[model samples]
Target: MNILFYNDSQDQLFHISPRQRRVALAVALIMAFLTLAALFFAGTKLPVMSAFFPVLGAWGVMGDVLTSFILFNQFRSSRIFPLLLLACTFLLTGILSLFYLLSLTGMLPLSGLFASGSQTAVWLWCFWHSCFPLGILLFMGSLHFNKKIIDRRLLPRYLFSGTTAVLLIGVLLLALATAGQDKLPVLIEDGNYRRLIETAVGPAIWALCALASVCSVFPYKKRGVLRVWLSVAVFAFLLGVTLSLAAGERYTLGWYGARIDSLIASTVVLLSIISEVNKLFVRLRRQHEELEESQQALESANEQLKELSGIDSLTRIANRRKFDEVLKQELNAPQRAKEHLSLLMIDIDFFKAYNDHYGHLGGDMVLRSVAPRLEAEALAHFGFTARYGGEEFAIILPGHSELEAEQIAELMLESVRSLAIPHQYSDVSDQITISIGGCTLRPGEKSNAHDFIGRADEALYRAKHEGRARFVFANSARDSCLHPFETTSH
Candidate 1:
C-alpha cells in the first residue's frame, strides 16, 4: 500500500507481488504468440490481403518480437521464454519472406539495371542468402549468450570466451569477403567502389553486433565498454553506407543500401532489448534487498515481544510465574554439587494502615520504595529478587549458607529502616519499616522449594507479630514466640 517514487535516473518501479508477476507473465506470453503469427503470414505468398493488413501485421510482429525477447532474457523460466524463442525462429522465417517480397514487388531498383546474367546479380544473390542465415545465427547466438549469462554467476569467464569467438570469426569472415572482392572484375571494371564498400562493411557490422551481444553480459558499472562497441558498430554501418552511395555505381549503391538499412534496424532493436533486461535485473535486486531487511526487522520485533511477555509490567522485573520456575530449577540441582540456597520473604510493615491513612497511591509509593531497597540489598549479597505479591517480595540467594542468609536479611532490614518515613497510626512502630524472614537449605536435603518458602513465611509471620521491624531466622525458637505486647493482650 505504501507508495514509492523513483526519480528518472533510477530504474523502473519493480512490482513484487505475486499478482503483478502473473500479469506480467501473461502479457509476455500473449505478445510472443502474436509476433509469431504476424511473422508467419506477412508476405505476398499469404494471399488474404486487405489494404490495412500489412501495416497492422508489421506492428503485431514488432510488438511480439520485442516482448518475446524481453520475456526470454529477463524471465527465462516464465512460460514466456520458451514460447517467445520458438516464435522468434518463425518470425525470422517471415522476415525472409519479406526479403523475397521486396525482390518481387519491384522495389529493388538495382535488380533490373544489373542484367540477370551479370556477376553483380550472382554476388547479390549470394549476399541475400548470407543475410538470412547470418541473421538467424546472430539472433540465436545473442539469445544463447544472454541466457547463459543471466542464469549463471560466472559471467566474466563466459563473456571472455564469447567475445573472443565473435571477434575471431568476424575478422575471418571480413577477410574472406575482402579477398573475394579483389577478384570480382565487374566490381573492378565498373569502378563500383560501392560494391567494394558493401563487401567490406558486412563483416564489420556483424562483428560490431557480436561485440554488442557479448558486452550485454557485463554489470552496469562496465556497460560503458559495451556501449563503446555498439557505437563503433553503428559508425561502421553508417560510414560504409555513405561511402557506398558516394562511389556512384547506381546498381551497386541501391543493393548495398537495402542491406545496410536492414542491419541497422535489427541492431537498434537488439540493443534496446539488452537495455531493458539490465533495467529489470537492477529492479529485482533492489526488491530482494528490501525484503531481506523487512524480514530482519520482523525477527527483532518477535524477540522483543518474547522478552516483554516474561517480565513483570509494574515492577519491571521477572514476574512471580518466572520466579517459581527459576526457583524449582535451582532446588533440583544435584546434592554432590554442595550448593546452598536461601529465600527471603519481605513485607512492608503496617502497609494496610499506611494505605488507609495516606491512600492507596501512597501505599504504592511505599511498596515501590521498599522493593528497590530490598533489590539493592539482595544484589549486594549476589541474590535474585522478585515482587512476590502486593507489599511483599522474595529474594533467592543460590550459594549462601544460613549465616550469610541471616546477615543479608539483617542488611535488608537496616536498609528499609533507614528510609525513616513516619507511620503515625501503626501498632508495631512509629517509622515505615520492613520485616524480612529468610531460610537457607542445602540441595537433596529432603526439602522442596515450597517447604523452604513455607519456613520463610513462618519466620516472616513471627517478625510481623514481634514488633514488625526485624529479621527472623526460620529455625529460631524466638520466631515461634509472639510480640511481647500481643502476648500480654492474650
Candidate 2:
C-alpha cells in the first residue's frame, strides 16, 4: 500500500503502459510539429506574433513553479540528491522566466534585472537555460562519484546556501551587464554585427545542455523512463535555443516558437508528477484502513487473554488468583460498608487419605465433583465461588448475614453428602464430607483483606478440631455458631 514510487524495489512511475507511451509520443510529436509550423509561418509577421510571446513565457514560468513544488515534496520525503538538484533547477528556471517575461515587456524596475543593454534579455535567457543543464550534470555526478552527499541532515543547509549563492551571483552579473550595456553593440540592429560575447555564450549554453542530455542516457546499464524524458526535455530546450538565435530579435516568429517549446518541456515534467501524486494518495488511504482493522483484532485478543488468566484450568472455576483479587476489592470497596459480606472457607475432610486410597486421578475427580456443588450453594444465595487450593474452596456472599451464610453452608454439606462418594480409608465416614467455616462483617471493620481471611481460617481450624461434617460461624459473639452433624447413613 505504500505508493511511494521510486527506482529501486519500489513501484516507479517510469514503468508506463503501452497505451500511455503511445499517447505521450503522439502529444510530443504534435507539439514539435506545431512549434515548427508556427516558427515558419510567424517569421514574416512580427507585430502580431510579438503579443503572444509574453503569454507563453508566463505559462512556462507557472509550469516550472509547479514542477519545482512536486520535486520539492519528493525531496522532503526521500531526501534524494537527484530530486533536490532537479527541484532547485526548476525553481531557478521559474525565477529566470519571470525576469525574462518582465524584461521583454519593459515591466522590470531596473534595466539591469534581465539585460546589460540591447542584448541584456538575451544574456539572461542564456543563463536561465544553462542552470537546468548544470543541475542535471551535478545530479549525474552525484549518482556516480559523490554517492554519500544525500545525507538528510545536511540537505537543508546545502539547498539554502546554494540558492542564496545563485541569486547573489545572478544579481551581481545583471548589474555589471547593465553598466556595460552602452559599450555593447546592438546585435539585432539594421547594420550592427554580433559581438564575441553574444556569439560565444548562447551556443556554449546550448552545447552544455546537449552534452548533459547525452550523458544522462548512460547512467545505468539500461535507460529508465525518467532519463529518457529528461533527455527529451533537454533536446526540446535546445531546439528552443536554436529558434531564438534564428529569430535574431525580440518579438519575432522564432521568439514565439522558442517560448512554446519551453512551455512544452515544463508541461511534460508537470504531467508525470501529477500522475504519481494521484497514485500515492490512493496507496496511503488503503494502508490507513488496514492499520485500523489490525488494531481492533489486537484489542479483542487482549480481552480474551485477560479473562483466561483469571480462570482455574482443572476445576473450571475461578482460581485462587481470582479469589484473592475479588476479596481485596470487596474488603476495600466503599459500598460493602452498607451491607453484610460473608466469606466461607470449605475443605474436604480427610482428602489426603482419600487420595492415598484412590490415586491422584481419583483425587482430581473428587475436586472437580465438589467444585460445582459449592458453586451451586453460593450462586443460589447470590454469592461467588472459587477454588482456593487443592481440595479446598472459598465462597463470597456480598449481602448475606451470619444466619443466611450458616443455612447456605448446611445446604453445601448436604449437597456433597448426597454424592455418596466412597472413602474407606477416611476416619470420619465412608462417604465424602466437607467442613465449612464462615465470617460475616462490614468491609470497614477490617484494616485489610488478608486480616479478614486470617479470621476465617481460625474458624475453619476450630471446625476441624471439634469434628468433621460441621459448620462454624465466626465474626462477633452475636454471629458465632458451631453446628455439628451426627453420624449419618453409611
User: What lDDT would candidate 2 get against the real structure?
Assistant: 0.71
- Per-residue CA lDDT of model 1 for 59-96, tens digit only, reads 43354355334433433332222223333432442343
Residue lDDT tens for model 2, 175-228? 544565555544445412234236576667768877876776564334334554
Cα lDDT computed for each candidate against the true fold: 0.52, 0.71
Off by over 4 Å in 2: 1-23, 35-42, 46-51, 110-116, 182-186, 190-200, 219-225, 283-490
The alpha-carbon RMSD values of the candidates against the true structure, listed in the order shown, are 20.4, 19.7
Question: Local error of candidate 1 at 58, Å?
Answer: 99
Q: How many residue pairs clash in each candidate?
A: 0, 3
